[model samples]
Target: MGNIVSCCSLDENKKYLNDDEILETFSNSEINEFKKRLKNNIQIVVLLQDGTKLPCNLQANFQEKTLCISCHQKVKNKND
Candidate 1:
């Protein structure tokens, strides 16, 4: 909606970011952040190493060694 920014490549992905740094950590924080972002219509996206883009929740299990999600269906990458 905001000019349709693209996350088209794995190289464009961001470095590992822990939840404490910028994301909403607790339940209340998560709700508040979601509400605030929705209210302001802010865009939040995630680009995985394989160039797959998805809207990630505030807290996700990304503790795996490589931070990879082998998504079979993605609009950005279409791995399958």
Candidate 2:
């Protein structure tokens, strides 16, 4: 793993999206494109910490200003 982009916090048991950081990681336009794809209900893949690319559905919550990604299989860290 390069750097921990984002992770499911153990305490909250919630996935954290470093929106600002993620935007910086990729082009801002790319982020917007992802949003568009999500709006279209297109399935997308998210790269996990352990270098696993998982297929998931992107859910955007405007109110919360967050992206919720759901994958069918369980995701685990490489160390695990």
lDDT of 1 by residue, 1-80 (tens): 57757767565576766878555446887877766655444445668687767664343332442222233344653556
Whole-model alpha-carbon lDDT for candidate 1: 0.54
Worst-scoring 10-residue span by lDDT in model 2: 8-17
lDDT of 2 by residue, 1-80 (tens): 59996775475776677877656778779978977876656688888776788888877776688877778877774563
Candidate 1 has what TM-score?
0.21
For all candidates in order, the CA lDDT equals: 0.54, 0.76
Give me the displacement of residue 46 in model 1, in angstroms.
Answer: 14
Q: Where does candidate 1 stray beyond 4 Å? A: 1-26, 44-80
Model 1 pairs in collision: none
Local error of candidate 1 at 22, Å? 21
